[model samples]
Target: MESIYIQTPLGIAKIEGDKQGIATLSLVEDVALSNEIPSCLQEAVSQLNEYFSGERNAFDLHLNPQGTDFQKKVWKSLEEIPFGKTRTYLEQAKILGDVKAIRAVAAANGKNPLWIVLPCHRVIGSDGSLTGYAGGLWRKKWLLEHENPMRQQSLF
Candidate 1:
């Protein structure tokens, strides 16, 4: 296991991974330079930097997000969400052909560990409200506003 930290618009992120692929991305306010990053971490860090700078719309880095089968399903669905679009949990559940599993789908979404890399922030409340982002609702709001093409004035 190896880790590297980089500054992003949201904050500094510590990314960890091995040859298998990137495993964890933890957001922090500061970086600890005590650790040496593995060679494999460079590409992931570069790609993530591009993403935060708005130079990259989608991530191409090899990811090995670890989770349950249902969580994986939800994460994959999150990936399918376009760069600047939002989807409701109910809609996501219906897309999975299980409309009644809305709460389960939301739960799976909440457990998404890869954060912005997995695009879980694209999921919103059924009424188009931001809610339940592990990274915090403010970050979610910022992300949605960042991804919007029109850049509407925010009430926040």
Candidate 2:
């Protein structure tokens, strides 16, 4: 697997992948950014840069996140979430066809390997609050706001 570290608004992002596709794109704590980006990860890096800059709202790269079958299902559902929308854990569980699986669905979401590409940040608490993001609630808030910047209303 090839890996490259790049600086992002949230922090240092460590991306790893190979010909099989990108397996992981995770946030790391205080790592020196690398000048060289692996060929396999170049597209991902570029797309991520565009995403942070608000030039792109969707990703068009092959992903190969590693996780259990249930987790993969949950992650796939997360990808279906719109760029500027949010889904509650209960809603996600309902989509999975088992509202009783809310806790399990949240657990799977917590384990999502791909961050922005899979858009785990779009999931929020049932009460419309930010909660349970592996990258921290602050980062989650930043990501959501970045994706959907609030527009100022005219006071005419």
Candidate 3:
């Protein structure tokens, strides 16, 4: 698999993929930025840069995240969430046709591998609270705020 590390507003982003598609896109504590991006990952990197710059609201890259069928289904559904919009875990479960699967849905969301592209960050708690995120709650908050068209105000 080919890989590349790029600087993002939040931190360094570690992107791994191959001809099949981008498999994993996650944040790493530290890593030197990649000087040369592989051809297979160039488009993904460009899209990500656009996303971070707010020029792009949706991703259109071929994704190949590895997971169980159920997980893939959940991730695909996550893509249905519109940019700058939020969905509660219960709402996501209902969208999947099984409100009782709320916990499972949230678990799958927590395991999402595509990061901002898949938009697991768009999912929140029933009470509109930011809950679980593999990239850390702070990053989650940052992502949600970034995607929000209404600028987030800073409190001193």
Best by lDDT: 3
Candidate 3 positional error at 20, Å: 0.9
**C-alpha RMSD of each candidate structure in angstroms:** 3.0, 2.2, 2.0
Q: Rate the local accuracy (lDDT) of all candidates.
A: 0.85, 0.92, 0.92
20-40 in candidate 3: lDDT tens per residue?
999999989766888999999
Q: Show the lowest summed lDDT stretch of 10 residues, model 1.
A: 28-37
Q: What's the true lDDT of residue 25 in model 2?
A: 93
TM per prediction: 0.90, 0.95, 0.94
Per-residue C-alpha lDDT of model 1 across residues 29-135, encoded as one tens digit per residue: 65564255579898887787787777888988788888999889888899899999989988899998899999999999888878788888999889988987988
Q: What lDDT score is found at residue 154 in candidate 2?
A: 68
Q: Runs in model 2 with CA error above 4 Å?
A: 152-156
Reference-based lDDT, residue 5, model 1: 78
**TM-score of model 1 relative to the true fold?**
0.90
